[model samples]
Target chain A: MTETESPTGSTLTIGVVKETKPGERRVALVPKLIERLTRRGLKVVVEPGAGAGAQLADDVFTEAGATTGDAWSADIVLTVVPPSIADIERLKPGTVLIGFLAPLTNTDEVAAMKKAGITAFAVESIPRISRAQGMDALSSQANVAGYRAVLLAAQRLPKFFPMLTTAAGTVPPAKALVLGVGVAGLQALATAKRLGAQATGYDVRPEVAEQVRSVGAQWLDLGIEAAGEGGYARELTEEERARQQQRLTEAIGGFDVVITTALVPGRKAPTLVTAEAVRGMKAGSVIVDMAGETGGNCELTDPGKDIVAHDVTICSPLNLPAEMPVHASELYARNLTELLELIVDTDGKLAIDFSDEVVAGACVAGRDEEVN
Target chain B: MTETESPTGSTLTIGVVKETKPGERRVALVPKLIERLTRRGLKVVVEPGAGAGAQLADDVFTEAGATTGDAWSADIVLTVVPPSIADIERLKPGTVLIGFLAPLTNTDEVAAMKKAGITAFAVESIPRISRAQGMDALSSQANVAGYRAVLLAAQRLPKFFPMLTTAAGTVPPAKALVLGVGVAGLQALATAKRLGAQATGYDVRPEVAEQVRSVGAQWLDLGIEAAGEGGYARELTEEERARQQQRLTEAIGGFDVVITTALVPGRKAPTLVTAEAVRGMKAGSVIVDMAGETGGNCELTDPGKDIVAHDVTICSPLNLPAEMPVHASELYARNLTELLELIVDTDGKLAIDFSDEVVAGACVAGRDEEVN
Candidate 1:
């Protein structure tokens, strides 16, 4: 596949630098991506120890036909994490840098990226679609976050989830209920069920009931009906909300572990589980709210901390994906590689054509001056 | 049934109290329980306007055969949320107090419950079993919490979850992943699905893959075997932990929402999702960590706050369940009534039977005082 598509006349140069942040592992460009880049006549340059944490030796870059040199002097700089203001200050204007800048809420970080005069490609900003699936960062890391949330819950939960017939006594299975049905919520349900808990789920969208039922657990519908354009929920009518809550209240008293994941982008999360419900739960019941970063769904939830309310503990953790940085970075790097190839031209030259929907969508935050 | 069991009955005194905590909407005992108590030849006494937030008026309590009076002076004192330390101190010695008392981490509160010499029963400490399920505060409340979490996540999410085919374009369904399969997690999953998102779930327990698949999501297994005695996972082994990371890294990129519910009882929550995972996620993705009350599963999750990292926002909301306190209280009241009826003696009298497993298990937390 690489032979015919190789850029014969020119070779493209991309730079890799050591991440300044302490405890930063994983590089933006991994050695595994070299063959693809080489076939396109794209040459990668790396600073010393760029891939040290990932165990990719310096010689590995050389073996892959990548040049070892002064990283800051390259036409485009590729980084893992975000570069510090000082690092950006050293860069020449019009240079392109690709990595996770955390643009949405990182005012200072986004400004820094802009000030660097570098075109930024947030790997985390990749869209989710069949064509963009390979470059979707949210899925790569959320998968880790979901797996980890369950492990955390299992550790703190007092009793087992599944029922057992023991000689001593009959141990009933734990009833697990999932809220929000998002990536982490689904993972939590799967994890709880795997642990032998009888799983059930609730959602506002009646259409999701099938998905919930497909998971071998009962699908709890609050009888909420909603329709919106382009994968966004139209705001609910107050009456619909009331009916939904009414149904939810009646269905609530049976579960053990309550994992909540509900949120609106760029807004405070709505509350799903109420204090009275927490009080109604069994002793030693546990809840892990994944929306802690945006606010929380459980009344007892305290973002980034642990609080026991009415004997029910609500836990909200931050940076769930980073805890597994090794895999996270690897996945993100692959995504970056895929996204980069699409933007690069056949001449092995840099070209970001925003006319393409994928490029335009991914480049939403960038100003005209940031990229050509 | 009520007429059949009236031979040995005398009017039992039931007491209700106002919560002393700031912004507390929950009353001592709700109307549903009061009706049950009254049916059992119990005279119900409630503080004026006790159930206002719960929408049960004082007239309703009075009409149901309850008397209004100073809750502190009643024969039995019940309050929602938790009583202030001062209220505990003021209670008469040996008076029975029933409410949500967070005992494990609140040593001072536990000490107060003990020092006051009140036979305090933390409603949340109820055991979870077939017979004891009705009394299970954790289950009842978690159900509400789980429902609320999904709403919160949906509200905060940038887009709606369900797919839409409109004149504008084909809007692919938002993708959601759930982390744990506990009650809250399941609810979140169901809610997210209903909101029109493609849902997926993962867990450390392989047994839950079927459940996740049943929920209409393609289940991705981390392939880490669990070692839990009661169908719960013990702390993961170090090697298994690495494998888990690998599994999540492969799966996280496509999700638009992630809900996390992971915790351990009486212990700090294990760090599951890390910052790298957050960075790897898409810019608009939102993560709701339900583990905020415990030390969060996400390393970057801050309890009771909203934070944006790597363009992905993480939220850990505190007291989410309280946001919808009215229904929460109602559900709890029914659960308590069911529980109280289960333990009520045939003589129309309250009985504390330590010999019963339900009572024995329920009497788990608190000041550790014993009363007959």
Candidate 2:
């Protein structure tokens, strides 16, 4: 352990590393967060260009009292995504690595973490409870993705989102249909509504209709309820799926823009917009599939590509949160800060209390082997 | 005359030609308007792929009773842009060519039209009066350009336009500053407001402050009045120009988006956003120069390109109205239809009433040789 003691006390060293994932433009921490951490008696070491993706220059971090250096020697490291195998090898034994570590699907990384004897906390594993709401990084990032998806659709769509009466005639507002009512979906609906688009939202869970209405968007009732545990939609029955698809196909044809955010966690995103439905849409319409990374909710969506289907533009963008990194980083940094307070004790020492529900739930590796 | 006599009467032939200007996507008439023309006992002919840029397939025009043929042989030829020298040569004598002929700037085209003996009506020459409001193509096209400029800025901007309140914190709304309060500038302000941006506008004319305030944007007063004749800003005095530049340079630094639409009709667009002003703007801020074609208002703007200067993305788009061809065409076609009604007689014969103010103002050639 590379622990150093100051005259006042032993300060907890927090390291921020630049994301290595291609097209990942968001940083785990920003310059504003550096002062907040330093004020809490924590020493921050940021790798050069770590916050460049977020448009936060290295000098800005230094101005906020963060030291410019190689952060591999720090006690705790912060990352937005799962670190590469090479990066995992750089960490010292017993070093704590924190991020959206997918311990369920990334078994290889989990095994490597065990071999390296490094403690790992997955932000994705944070319980969706009232107290942990502020620490929910997934929800924070999803909010950004949701807002960006509407803009992408608006930019791609040939028509205006709002209606206007001019000397020539009145141009009607664009009709938008949003699939799913999660954090990302709600934000998309709110953004579309704000842009003056007549927005409608659909979710498998019937209870989210009220949330959709709260954002000034109409609720699309499919007449089927599939609300699952933990606020996720359950896998639908064959009959229910067929009926849902039929209703969506008929309803989606009337919309000028469609934003799909339906995801089943680690599973493939459900097909909400079929090829026939896309063909039925008016020419020059736009569809933005937010769940493109794990197989899109649209049948015709090509991940990371803008494709035209029957004259309708379908954009399957990956890492939308990264595209607007300034605010994205700010939100993510705050989430990590809240989570850090829970993981660290008052003496500036790492304390993983297994008895604490949040600690037990978010702990992916480091505790005795019961993690997925 | 290429008039074909039907059993009912001798019908007028209205021809639509493809625009030759590079990056010009708008067609003079869409398929939707073809039916309106044909209903007035008029024969409609469309050149192959004339409406393709506007996403209206040739079959759609044919379905609306328009025949695919060479438009040059028709008595009345409609175009979106001024005809090329070669196109002028193809026109028969007494042919009526209608479009936004830059009568003031294109001296060669005006002389060519006179030599060819073609009756030309420039849409840009249409007088801005109450009765001619429906025929104002400049205002119609400029409206589309302004709305599109905001969308372009929003797409390129790294942050959200609206004030978003999330669990992490509240992200303040993006501040947008629009220079000039013409039809385009006003539309841009409204669009930015619709997107939830806190928009501010600056104009040399003091009277347009009410127009800016009407769109819910704060009026930026440079304390120098340069309101000129015909509703355009006059040439600013050197001392007044200096004061305006100084105030703008300081004010522009605070805005996230700056849209400059200051154009003096025939003269080179006034340099509104200087290089020093651009350098003072925040990094990742956007500047959309709407007066790009008539020599940009921003010093750093390279027409038809997106350049980053002092960390600010300056987009000088060429033909923004063409990018949104669907509605742009609809509005332009309506303007042309209203203008056509004034020039064409009740007996379905070509008649140029030089005594009518709308006709006299719109006529660029054929009302004696001195019209150009």
Candidate 3:
């Protein structure tokens, strides 16, 4: 294997294609990363207007050593979203595809890629081990979503987040409670605290209390610890669920803003904010339900809508990272770059070692049935 | 005069009227202040749904020692906006009225109140003195507008306001600039800083440099000063204005967010942000023009509307205080209460003292020829 040589002794080409999903403004590769790929003797081809959504013009990509061409015909295709079935038909048998292919849920897409004999990598399927942390696109995008959720809540709430002493009187700081102290929830708490709100974080996993406090927010303990394997809370027992709901309902009323980010990998999001809890909240308070895509953490949440229930604004924005396309695309590109470094050999030849845990875990198609 | 007696030997009746102006959600009084008025032996009457916009139900006011009735018929009418001609006609000849009368601009409204023999006190006309600071409704409302402007800018921006270090990469903090150093501008700078943005403030009045720095923002010095009378900047000379604009255009390009609050009394807002400046800014940058009601400080601003010009979002929301009706009403009610304490004698009878500077300055009508 040599620089600029693929397994078949031809120049290896990485293609950056424009995202086709509706409202998906992020791009998988940014111009800033073009040099890194090209420096390794990889030829870069970007479809015209591929990075437009992320504010990178075609000229910028061209200036960064990328050529405008048919990206679908390249050796490897980079995308923000999973390619459609029609897009899969455009790729050669040995072509490699990489992006957020929902392997667990979009089984049909995975089967289609397998039938086409295309090697595919699902960013969401990347292992959570220490070595693969830089390739964790889910956590990177969730960080953006969490930060955006707080800004949306602040914009909609008819009050100041921080306390202020003016000529008329002093206004007390708004109290914000974040349910589920995952990466997104912790980021939401940090953002709220940055805006001068008195922030509090709650999670069924008691171990996350220290992480919440590190962001300058209080930790709410409800005495329900469901620390499950793989860093997720276990499904609560029937009795535990009832107790959690009652305690959360009582505690929610005291906060002016609430952000819910509890989500199960392959299950509907748990209903953390019930209708009764919403009714008890003060008028003009805000709730940003980050689990809107998975049936929402709030009982009254209408996915991808902003509604007022019981005089409280409930915002359930889907794909919040797309709303902030520039930074979201930049981070996603970096995550892809880290993953690329693992699969691409030091000599710049196409090489995928299945023995590597990250490479094996992220592969969804074009592998032996037993290995898969 | 007795505690329960008016000039006409009747109980002093203070009425809280529902604001009739379009999009004006704030009421003249809130339920929390009802007991304060009643404790002075004054009878309080609230129009039905007067505090609805502020989330204070009619029953809440009634529970706080107020009665639901025809607010227009009370001896003293309290309002959030200047009353219309039809409303003035409903008032008794000797009735006292107070609110943001816009005495200098809305001359016809003042003349109508005078012709109807109603004693009108424009909150905007309140003298800027230490004793009258609590009665300065303009300052109070401006503070809310300033705080909201930053939030609006943050929401519209596609990037995070604060810097973040993640596994993917580090995001630099957003740079925010505020043009004007008045109450609203100062608050805008403080709020932007609170959200962790690198904030800078610019003002024609060089004296406000200290106030800008006190809010944790750098002062942009253009080497041109226009210190005017009565705590406002004077009109800049043509040469100085050209020099200022040229310098500002260069400085504005470096900021991600710009909030403009530069306005002259009874005149169109100065063009602090030119069209060229908007074009010079990076794509997805935001500009919130707080001077929208008096035209805008931005060349491309559409007053009372949110529009994008030259790839920059320009939000010129009018009456921002009304958008946050809860705190806006609370602060305005407190300001009115402070003014009421000055006019309402210890015996609880109406005392019109022209000798007092605040009273004389605030009185827009119902005074003798010279005193007015």
Task: Grade the docking of candidate 2.
Answer: medium
**What is the Cα-based lDDT of residue A252 in candidate 1?**
61
Worst 10 residues of 1 chain B by lDDT: B1-10
Of the two candidates 2 and 3, the one with more favorable TM-score, higher being better, is 3
Tens-place lDDT digits, model 3, residues A220-291: 999999999777899999999999999999999999999999988878999999999999999889999999
lDDT of 2 by residue, A1-372 (tens): 122233335687899998889888888888877766776678899999998877888998999999988887678899998887788999887678889887777888888887887888899998999888988899989988998999889887777788867887778999999999999999999999988899999999999999999999999987988999887899899999999999899999999999999988778989999999999998889999998988999999999999998989999998899898888888999999888878776556666677778888888887774332
lDDT of 3 by residue, B237-342 (tens): 9999999999999999999999999989888889999999999999889999998889899999999899988879999998889988888898999999999988
Better of 1 and 3 by DockQ: 3
Cα deviation at A188, candidate 3, in Å, is 0.8
What value does the lDDT take at residue A331 in candidate 1? 63
Cα deviation at A102, candidate 2, in Å, is 3.2
Q: What's the CA error at residue A153 for candidate 3, in Å?
A: 1.1
For model 2 chain B, the run of ten residues with the poorest summed lDDT: B1-10
Candidate 1 lDDT, tens digit per residue, A1-372? Answer: 121121334455778887787766556776767777778777788998787655466888889879898777666677776677788787776666777766666657668767666667776555555788777666655655665566556544544444533211344677888877655666566656655678887766566667666657677766676745333345568887667655665566667677777766556777778777787876557788888978887766889898888757678976665544544555666777788788776567776776667776676244476334
**How much of the true contact map at the interface does candidate 2 reproduce, as a fraction?**
0.60
* Residue runs of model 1 more than 4 Å from their true location after superposition: A1-372, B1-12, B227-232, B364-372
lDDT of 1 by residue, B1-372 (tens): 011222234444556776666656555566655766776666677878777655567887887678887777554566666677888877777556677777666668767777777666677666556666656666556655655666566545544344433211233667888887665676567656654568777666777677677656666666676645433456787887777765675567667778777666657776667776777776557888888988687789999888988767788876555554544575567666665665455455666666676666555322254432
TM-score of each: 0.50, 0.95, 0.96
